[model samples]
Target: MFSPRACEGDTNPVLIPFLLAAAAAAAAPPAAMRLDYFHTGDAREERFALDAVVREGPWPGPPDRRLDDTGLGRYQFEVRDAKSGEPLYSRGFASIYGEWETTPEARDRARGFQESVRFPEPEALVTVTIKKRDARGVFQPAWSVTVDPAGPAVDRRPPPAIKVWAVMKNGEPADKVDLLLLGDGYTVAEMDKWHRDAKRLADTLFAVSPFREHRARFNVWAADTPSEESGVSRPSDGVYRRTALGTTYDAFGSERY
Candidate 1:
């Protein structure tokens, strides 16, 4: 649902986790929030140049009894290869507000509100649509988002995607090869961030025993996907442990969380 350049701004504060006591004074109009794509754990501070987008909007301002009514909201996001103009992941949803309050002076307030949330990564876009519901139960489009105008970095030599196969000795499958997948438990964008980690793991494996001796006869697997589902709960499913990090999920390469 993202077009292009719906709104724009500097690297201002887009999202402050919902605990600001001064939120009333911090509300504002929609602004383009910039974010970077990083490969997980390259270095605590070393981030790869990938494209990500963030937008802020649907904020309540000083009362306009005859005109405007909305509240402050923010989103912290990350996406990988998004700036490459490639389709990877995509979603679209709206944010709604309910539980509201009013001060002695008759100012409207909100307590435990709801908002429609949509994330579309496969579309090479991350979209947030916020709408407000009025007393008569009507929905109105509040704000929209799109980002990363700079595009993705150009690489003459893009690394190969991870692939796994049985090691072959004279074209015959061999055994005992170990595949290790590593990653960060933080965000979906981290999947791209872990690519380097995966390569590093492969190199390390090649430097070690049994693996080193049978370098051509051994293979390593790298599950290059983010662990975003690790913290989520799903019923009627088998419990899964994240081997790369200390998180758990009912996840696999082909299974939906």
Candidate 2:
């Protein structure tokens, strides 16, 4: 979730034994906090509602880099101390709902989608806000919710019991910039193939320019779950299979997308 972008590292069935952490601070990085919520609306209007708060793995980001100054993505989220209203952490991210609302279909129908934002856990109650871009591409607050990191409502359960293993482990996840390769659409019978694929991708990444030169700064990890069927749902060809990560080839009605 830290800078590699959410499409890969964030939402995947893990192999099981992974603990990706971050660069050192005076103290250990805070535990990662995930806020799950609903994104619902039509093209004309949108809304957000809290779904859940989760205590995930240890924080795997640069401790000093608490604020995102890059100005990237169509949406942004900010975590602020509830009392003083001082910003604690912030990040810019793009979401499926952000893309869906642009499609012609959204204009005719109202729909709801699930979305989540992750940040370093805070000590006291904090207000998390989601913002969206306006006509001039300026971010405006879309929703805000207050959360207590240690509250009973936070889900502290461990991740799902999928098998997790290191593709290349230089050190513990907390010590290095970790990259995760998630295998989607592979069945239990094809786990071996998934492992191979993950290895190939990780190796290729490290073999390239910037990654190769600074390879020691990174660790590659991987995981996936068994799907009932093989392959993904490719609607363009009428080929459909139920997979753990239900990623389809013909997204947004475009085969190339």
Candidate 3:
């Protein structure tokens, strides 16, 4: 359960259900696993190679909702039992690589993007499959790899040390939507401002229609590593600065991103 100080004095009776859910989640939840890979391709050819399998922190999603039924995104990945071929988990997601592949630059040359997919740590050996949507919008296998949770090849290094705090806490993470706010270019001196901005953004998000009505069903978290400088680089303006997260302006020729 989150500390009482996390949410301050904005208590409402509506928060009780979410709080109860949080308590249950804390009792027993699976560890999170991440598959990091290089997605290399162009307009005509594509390839995927495994980089590392890492144990992330605790699984924050509901244990019951292991399979994603939503048919969204340009790509999907599935984890299946090695012997039975039974799917244990799946998710649909979009990636920067998926979008970049459609650009004219992809036709001119090959490129690669670092990507990661996260899921609950499985109990046994599993085969992971990556699928992409065809021209007719059907998903076809792009890559597949086998994973052993206890394999010597799996990387178990601890995640980077950074401060994290809850902006809003409703209940156990498994029972609620968890939103992570990642600050891109804030400097060490501006971390306080970043925290305030995260809270303000959460407030703004919950002030909208659907979110406002069901605000109790969500948790907001914020984490950031300070950049040496205070702003992102804008190559169009001939200005550059090293940032902690390496985000830059004019990605894909879009100045505002």
Candidate 4:
């Protein structure tokens, strides 16, 4: 017999609040956005000159590298509240490619000395607060960074010291040309090796006739330490991260070197 049968079901009811919550969460706006800096290449300067001289045993480094029009890149961010925009806390870091230059011995020597390493102020910080308002608008965080005026915190860690020398084509004073010498931290033995390497680097420059002929006219110096206690690095989760070094670069690349 093909008779229709009645189905039995539970009497418990579903909660309306739970279903609404699920819908709200699914419709909420995205929280993160990305910015690129590759288009800004004219801001950096040529800080190194191979044709400079090394008169003094070691030379002092420049105050800091300045940012120019080509230094920065596109940026974007989202903020929840302007009133609560203050930073809960902040920190930074710096580093030199130990592999960028210097021989193994010098790299070892540079590990010993601890000194001040200067960096551009205003690396980046929260400035403007982007939020959802009465009008249709995108939320973006305004930010800025600066070098601390207090100076480098003396490193108590037993690390190496690094030395840098610049040799120009014509013997000229160090102040005559713009230069920037960067370093990574090291051990005591590494400091000694770095000093020796500094001399070696100078000698290598002189080996070239153009620099050799102008050797007497050039100047030489060393940075007592790395750029800062934290060492140089871009802001975390920042738009300027890739743009600051390689992307927005104004000068000094494989083609130039």
The lDDT of each candidate is 0.37, 0.87, 0.90, 0.32
Write candidate 3's Cα lDDT for 1-257 as tens digits: 65667557766455778888899977778889999999998989899999999998888888788899999989999999998999999999998988888888988999999999999999889999999999899999999999999999888898889998889998988889889998878998999999999999999989999999999989999997799998888988998988998888888777657
Better of 3 and 4 by lDDT: 3
- Give candidate 4's TM-score: 0.25
| Tens digit per residue, CA lDDT, model 2, 44-103 | 999999999999988888777789999999999999999999999999999989888889
Q: lDDT of candidate 2 vs native? A: 0.87
Error of 3 at 47 (Å): 1.0
Give the Cα error of residue 174 in candidate 4, in Å: 7.8
* TM-score-better candidate, 3 vs 4: 3
Models ranked on TM-score? 3, 2, 4, 1
> Regarding lDDT, does 2 or 4 come out ahead?
2
- Residue 214 of model 3 has an lDDT of 94
Cα misplacement distance, residue 238 of candidate 2 (Å): 2.5
Candidate 3 global TM-score:
0.86
**Candidate 1 on 145-246: residue-level lDDT in tens?**
453333353222333454433222222222333444545453566555556666676777678887688886554555554554444333336554443345
- Candidates 2 and 4 compared: the better one by TM-score is 2
* 1 versus 3: better lDDT goes to: 3
Clashes of each: 22, 7, 3, 60
Q: Provide the RMSD of all predictions against the true structure, rounded to 1 decimal.
A: 24.0, 12.7, 9.8, 25.6
Best by TM-score: 3
